[model samples]
Target: MHTPAPTAPAHARPRAVHWLTTAAATAAVIAGAALLQPAAATASPDTAAAAQARPAPDAQAATYPLECRGGAPRVVNRATGDLDGDGHLETVAVVRCDAGIGTPPSGVYVLTSPHRVVATLLDPGDGENVTEIAVAEGAVAATLLGYSSDAVARCCPDRMQKVKWQWRNGKFTRSATPDARGV
Candidate 1:
């Protein structure tokens, strides 16, 4: 009875090995990216300067109303500026496209008083969803009106942007937007 069967020749083997390798490699790469996290937000020179330049968060409140709109409904840094004014500052919006008054599009969110923006009953206006939202610095008061039925693409920040972005190490970063001619 017998000798053990010999191993199959490479040519006789199933191509399934190649397919399995490709699938495994692809899955590994996807997993790596999904698990990747942004580097810790180190304070840049500008951040340091901004911190030094602005008044203490509490001190600037009475003078500027230093409202912030990000990272939950907490108070702002206190000494911050209009940030792009789109009425609210980036601090309050948490990111761009903040929904200051209602549950706006998903990207950015504008912060209101802890209790203010609670239940945005969709156009349930009557000041129910129309919370005291922020607007651009020079924007008209009428523009502060909130939407009711649905959010339209018209919600993109109305602030005129003069972004002067630069490609840094394969990424874009902006130093500032120069003053506009008439703006």
Candidate 2:
């Protein structure tokens, strides 16, 4: 017959459990604090300083690829963000012809540093007007307003679409958002 091992007194059991629980909680707190620390810097100090010193591309200085009938292209709305994951900011501008009365189609253009137009995300020839445009998380998003048919008036858009463009495979790919619908 095996002899039973001596157990701690009942009064000490609670204290033992409390000590274990406290130890576990202290360990958890240490691990969490370690995780909260900033990661090691991957970029050099000079590179980081240069990136911070350089401002994002200016929308007003870049020339758009829209052909307006005697009127110049004007930037209506613009947003700046890093669209290529290159740590440099780019400008996304929603531009349209400076029309006197009617609404003109808007073109979305991406501009890089030094105010150079790098890509045209949207062409004005598509006959769609961008009401809202934004750049975030290395992507460009816009709300386009368009006519359903020729009978629809230009001033009143019957079709509404939300689109996003992300840099992929050496080019920007467009995708429609799930909530995109006509108004």
Candidate 3:
């Protein structure tokens, strides 16, 4: 008879208490995670839309030397280098415009930031084409390939002009090299 108090018949209340405790802990953890979410992630869709409608800050908005037309300029070639020796990697992209049936307008653009085209390295006319572009020695070397004259058809370029672009006075200056070749 010292055998015992019968342990209260293994009360179901204890099991219920344990389940409630686990449920409360799980809810707390989930609530904490939602509160700690990033501002953008927690924002409502309308709030996000309103934020996007606001103008970009000046520090974030860079001014470009040239403007693209017809649509967002199409990037044909791209390279990366410290073009201005600023220790920051600058982007050199050869962009072309679909102006008309003739050779598309094209140019070399340098960007310190993605949203801005900081400099126009080489701008080819409506019928001119930029065949090749490269970045070296903090300078841009571009090959202007296009018809020799206005009479030449749009089949293939007949003349190849080599041009060098250098960064100077906070801008780009183009110089025609003597290596004009024929394709």
TM-score of each candidate?
0.21, 0.73, 0.55
> lDDT per prediction?
0.34, 0.89, 0.68
Error of 2 at 143 (Å): 0.7
After superposition, which runs of candidate 1 have C-alpha atoms over 4 Å from their true positions? 1-14, 51-53, 56-183
* Candidate number of the best lDDT: 2
Count backbone overlaps in model 3. Answer: 0
Evaluated at residue 8, the lDDT of candidate 1 is: 95
Task: Assess the local accuracy of residue 5 in candidate 2 as a C-alpha lDDT between 0 and 100.
Answer: 100
Where model 2 places Cα greater than 4 Å from the true spot, the runs are 1-49
Worst 10 residues of 1 by lDDT: 115-124
For model 3, residues 20-101, the per-residue Cα lDDT tens digits are 9999999999999999987764644564354345432231233434355664445777776667765556677776654545
Q: Candidate 2 lDDT, tens digit per residue, 76-99?
A: 999998888777888999999999
RMSD of each: 21.0, 13.9, 11.2
Which pairs clash in the backbone of model 2? none
- How does candidate 2 fare on TM-score? 0.73
Of the pair 1 and 3, which is ahead by lDDT? 3
Error of 1 at 107 (Å): 50
